[model samples]
Target: MPTRPSLDSIALMRQWLLLLVLAVIAGQVLRLIGMPAADFLGSMLVAIGLGVRGARIRVPALAFKFGQGCIGLLVARSLSAETLASIAHDWPVMLLATAITVVMSLLVALFLVRYGDLPGSAAAWGLSPGAASAMVALAEDHGADSRVVATMQYVRVVCVVLIGAVVSHALGSDVTPPQIPTGTAPLGFTVPANGILTILVLTGSVLIGARFPAGALLVPLLAGSAMQLGGVFIIDLPQWLLCLAYGALGCYVGLRFDRATFDFVVRRLPSMLFSALALIALCALSALFIANLLGKDFLSVYLATSPGGLDSMAIIALDTQADVGLVLAMQTMRLFGVVLIGPYLARQIIRLSR
Candidate 1:
């Protein structure tokens, strides 16, 4: 026999479900309105509005965190030795890009801190080129105000998503309503049981260590790639899982923008906007140069250059029918590479600036 849910608990659950539904509906509506990136931006707006207005919107923080944990697990299945080998071959280039991006981020952050009158930790976490959640958590750990960090990180994410969508649209891509994936593998493909088991194990590992914030995203990516390279496990996560991961991430991002943060963000709107555009431009130029040297198409290089979150970029790649696997592999490689070396680059920049 199972215990029944208390009335309060049931009410809370219902409220959470309603928020998720509303988020999805809002996201779709925005996409239909030719503002597909509005899903993410909308969430940020909602979160900031709530914070500012002192609205008691009960967000399902645990659910959002769990959803993020699943992203790496789902992505892990796509890793294999061939992909690993390719990443290894391009490791130097990827590291170089990561180094350059981190340096650029730090320089921008320092400028924002000194010239823009922002807190150092807030600026540092705000500009770090990982997921918004990772930056916020790190900022909190480092004693920055959580609200400010959350605002800055999500604002940047929204900018990246919007800019990406606009760039896609400008290139003559259709800006139509987004559709959820139907759970179907490509023709002649069947998921294996062993692959399923591997994903579960990897996911378990991530959850057990998720207290480390970005560790959940980073660990599985590295471990999964290693396991695949060693031929220890083949991964083939379900399409539904990937869709859920994307939706959850988007929803969480949307809900992060409460009212107080919005006002704060609005106050520094010009500087923040300039910083984001500058970073995007710098990354794009770097990618273009690298792509020219490698003889790759500009779009592929642009995706590689963009400092968006890995999961978001992967989703965009899938939607556009771009090389999803290559995008994921390259983005994952660069994320970990940057996270590992970002602080050192920041230190160097700090030294040079001083």
Candidate 2:
């Protein structure tokens, strides 16, 4: 549906301008409420609302791909050598937590497939305990309804963020996000040389993965991770750039929704909500046992295992004074694990369910 675009520049700007204005308003309100991935979710919800009401604008494909690449780099920032060392040191526990998460996600997927009549790939990827945006992109690559997957993933993200905040509060800590000094150069110090290099890495990775399945996201993630682990350079995406990426991605998923997809989501809203809640509860129980076994602080282990977006969990971890490194390490582990095996597991779960 070129419901798409044309060569007329003024017309194109006219179409996008209204959506952008609304998105900014929604995003700011959501951010003030401590909502997770506020920019992405606000834009997405606004787009979805417009789509259902017959809006006709869509994000260009190139823009969306760039957004995906930036998300990959954002994730890559977490994978430092020290983080890897901590993960390797606690390999058994880390693996146990990852395995439990994968298995539980599949079971939730199976339930949705068998009972809710949802597509298997979307269900599995939706429940996966990883970065929500990355999982949404991967689900799209592998033939799932990205609209459904995005909705499910965000639903669980909301659940995880709310519960994580409550747990952090109960444990005697404020749940406000950790603050960064304004206008500070990325990576916490001035490194304009490496900042330029980081941009090249992001750009090259995006171009390279443009044609590969989920490559736009995965390539930058792997490349950025390797670069960081080797001390070559830290990834240096500023908050404004990341907000732009999230906004593009949000619009892309949102504007593609048709009346039929909208109807399906509305009809299945209860099951989606139930599935998200059940998944969070199960992960929390597992985290309790694992924390005791590893003799780590419960809040630290719980946030690590929670199936929320990395940024949200990271905020909670920093605010709560939890072990930030371990939190990031486990989150990154589950994230990569989901990217590698989530699709295959979706197929297997579908087969077993039948």
Of the candidates shown, which would achieve the greatest lDDT relative to the real structure? 2
Q: Give the top-scoring candidate (TM-score).
A: 1
For candidate 2, list the clashing residue pairs, or say none. none
Error of 2 at 352 (Å): 4.0
lDDT of 2 at 43: 85
What are the lDDT scores of the predictions, listed in order? 0.62, 0.75
RMSD of each: 7.1, 5.9
- What's the TM-score of each model vs. the native? 0.75, 0.72
lDDT of 1 by residue, 1-354 (tens): 985332233454554565556566766676675553445544445444333444445446655655555555545555555755766677677667667777778778878777776766667767888766766666676576778767776677777777776666566555432332222233322346554655576667667657775666666666765665565555555545554555656656765555556667789888887878888888888878877765666665666668788766655554454444566766766666656654564455445545
Candidate 2: RMSD over Cα atoms?
5.9
Q: What lDDT is reached at residue 106 by model 2?
A: 83
Error of 2 at 313 (Å): 6.0
